[model samples]
Target: MSLHPVVLITGALTGIGRAAALAFAHEQARIVVSGRRAEEGEQLAAELRALGSEAEFVHADVRFEDSVRQLVQRTVARFGRLDVAVNAAGTEGEPGPVTELTPERYAAVFDTNVLGTMLSMKHEMHVMLAQGSGSIVNISSTMGSRGAPNVSLYAASKHAVEGLTKSAAIEGAAAGVRVNAIAPGPVETAMLARLTGNEERKTAFLASVPLKRAGAPEEIADAIVFIASAKAGFITGEILRVNGGKTAS
Candidate 1:
């Protein structure tokens, strides 16, 4: 990779995606932050530029192939090549029990978490394979590998993400493109708040973690940067768990 590698991130408007953009900017990487929201995306790009990294905001809805294709094309067009792509676009999607799940509910979560990740990888690999060198880091969750009550849809979607990450890694490895995923535990993000709902529930959830606390967005961002960097060059087809030893058992 070049001194200022071009990095593209989806769901860059908030949470871990936003933090990853900043973390890469701190490394002096050229970045493209993508999301459906134009205003927030533009602001994030400006912030990255302020930190001395070349940056741009591209609007994209990962659920659609056309949107994702345009996003990848625009990144390559503007930056010449894509060195790293962080697929952080996902959702919790109206958490409820399996008995309560409707097709509408399932689609709402799977479209963004599963289909979105797949499409992003499809297009990203297309460019990376041609270039013969690139890295892709996908975002997964602790629930991805474990079963949880009421959050079945989200967990199932993340399981699909892990499957995609591993399969894509195998396909891309021989072509010089590496794919991996970070399965985060509870993080102090807006999504976490929504998931927990109340302070009592949130505290109880954190107690399950050995660390007894939620992770910070920056912590996950740093991990993303490392796994996506040359430092973790030998690593692929793996899921780096960042969930405060929640899966230690």
Candidate 2:
């Protein structure tokens, strides 16, 4: 076996996931980054390679069970084993009042956020259990712990993710596979660009945050890297909030 570990990150083509790929690459960890965007995924893989890190791209859509399974299979095939798994693939559906939310919108959010994470973990953990050691970090949102206006669907999906994290951790403890979650606040990403239309809305969002600023993707990625590394070996089933104290208010 190589001295470096194998790290698999989903949704690694963009946002926080992209930052994490770079973070792990810098640590000399062999990386397998999976995402639906072939161009961006391949580009990131090339970037990692340029940094002298062993990396590969596996195209996958987490919402589909088969695609998620194939992603893990490809990772194992390439690296021979998986030491860490990050389920960072997620979606933000149309925001609206619960009464006005359509079944289509609800299903879309749940399918990608809840079902997607579950399927990815199921397949990843299967391999981990057999190896008798692994760690999983699921990316959730701060809204998972608190209710937010006009985001019931999204909030619910993240809450489900937290629940899955806890339950999986309990079950995997005996197998030496740790499971946890990372809940980030308003990070400077394309996903939050949708909420940056008006100055008042933007300020209001920041006002609740004690840091008085939006979080950077790199910051969130750092938290994830710590939780997924050997440093957090004794920790499991925790939702490490990287929300800039927004939930404090």
RMSD of each: 0.5, 1.3
**TM-scores of all predicted structures:** 0.99, 0.97
Error of 1 at 90 (Å): 0.5
Candidate 2 residue-wise lDDT, 154-243, digit = tens = 999999999999999999999999999999999989888775667688878787789999999999989998998888999999999999
* Model 2: lowest-lDDT 10 consecutive positions: 193-202
Q: Per-residue lDDT of 148-174 in model 1, one digit per residue for the tens?
A: 999999999999999999999999999
Model 2 has an lDDT value of 0.92
Which residue pairs overlap in candidate 1's backbone? none
Clashes of 2: 0
